[model samples]
Target: MASPDTRTQLLDAAERLFAERGYRGTSVRAITDLAGANLAAVAYHFGSKAELLAAVARRVIEPINAAQCAGLDRLLARTPDPPVAELVAAFVGPMYDEMRAGDEGGARTSRLIVTILSDPAEEVRSWTGPAEDAVRDRYLEAFTRALPDLPPQELWFRIRGILAVTAVDRVEVHNRLAGLPPVAGEAAKQWAITFLAAAMSAPPTGT
Candidate 1:
């Protein structure tokens, strides 16, 4: 059996390289090389490259999902019917917190999310799986309760937009809009929450 430390190193290396090179683009030898383990270490610890990718997805996504669920739990405990802004905040605050962390882990996570969101490959997206769906359903259910007036489809659209804004656009904007004045951490986070809340609360235009 590979030592626990080797397993951790492989995970860390895989995450970084996967974020940079993408799942299909990264190779087992490259992962092991970065991790300082033999090429067989991935097979020993994770069985295959697909399994390693899944493990990396779980490593980054589970914590964010757990934090979002916990935030929603706290909100629902106090206010069974939260305002859209509060609901949006509860759902997205953990993500922004991670983005604002200013560390290697945070950057890796941000890149991983962007990679997952933008990668057209079905397999790349499938890594999140039922865990992602379960958390998403919980939030959508909460939003439905909060805004029964809106059509369920509309609410889903807004929720997806909220996620895209927070997960993908936020990072892309920073890189692409370097010429623009930087929004400070707290201010930028609040801007996202406020913008998303407004979008969620908007009356659907009869099309």
Candidate 2:
């Protein structure tokens, strides 16, 4: 097999470290050391550590975003007004599928996404860009169609809330922290999907 180029090596290293230690915990030197490249390589290729992180986030997130959008599109094509549970499954299922079937690198990318979603560091939090906005808009549109009675602000709030909950559960469930039994494989995926669907379908508050 052909060897990975320097940029690819740097991205690989950044993804691993960002996923494992988070962006704040990882340093440019650590990434270079893991990639077997010199420190200047990151600057040369990505411009800065922040840019490298943005690139890593794009690589990890774009494919999954596409999958999610496509899934929702297919559902809408078949059923213009799909049920809430189906919409949730279409939108949220791809990440779980990736977690279940992707290789080790892919799994790390999934964790990296969850880390990015939950990371409190200002730099990490600010990394989201137009691509993510587009995905969010696409999903929001589909969900709006599914739940027209849901006030727009409430819908957006619930969506963000469930996403935060889901991110936490994905990490905590996978790590089996506090000696809690890990819910693995398909069961865990279903649990997450069901929880999200229920939250999305919940009656609007203050009705």
Candidate 3:
């Protein structure tokens, strides 16, 4: 049987490799080899390679989502509701914070999520539903209360899509905007919130 720490070791290695290489690119054998565990350790700990990938993705995604949800708590306490833009920032700022806080592995993993979100087989895609749903619930509640005029379904979908773009874009945006670095915690928080508020509140593109 694998020890407690062995599970962590396997997860750590899997997170890095899966992030550095897409799901199809990472192998259970490689993960066990990197983790210095026996081949059976992977199977023993996590039923299959797909489960290992899900575990790795969860490690990176859960904390960021947790932080965002915590930030939502603060946003909720404000009297008369803050603008939707502020809410958007709350959604994304935590992710950028983690990515910059020596969570390069997380930054890479976020990109992998973008890939998964863009296209994935049913099994892989099903893994994301609950995690994303939890985070989305926080925003759905917030927006539903604050922006009564905005269509609940459309607003949430748009908010989610934009948040994904913001999270994934930070790494690349840095590469393109040589002089302008990505926003920091509070700044990103405000910026994302503001962007969401405007986008959510804006009329349709054709209009």
Worst 10 residues of 3 by lDDT: 100-109
TM-score against truth, every candidate: 0.87, 0.85, 0.76
Backbone clashes counted, model 2: 0
Model 1 agreement with the true structure over 50-76: per-residue lDDT tens digits: 888889888777878888988888988
Residues 7-93, candidate 2, lDDT per residue (tens digit)?
888988898898888888898999999999998989998898988998988776777678887887798799778888987887677
Q: Output the worst ten-in-a-row residue range by lDDT, candidate 2.
A: 98-107
TM-score (C-alpha) between model 3 and the true structure: 0.76
Residue pairs with clashing backbones, model 3: 85-193, 85-194, 85-197, 86-193, 89-192, 89-193
Candidate 3, residues 61-103, lDDT tens digits: the string is: 7778888888887887875476667777777677666655445
RMSD of each: 2.6, 2.8, 3.7
Shift of residue 96 alpha carbon in model 1, Å: 2.2
Best of the candidates, lDDT:
1
Candidate 3 segments exceeding 4 Å error: 1-4, 129-131, 152-154, 170-197, 204-207
Measured with C-alpha atoms, the lDDT of residue 7 in candidate 1 is 93
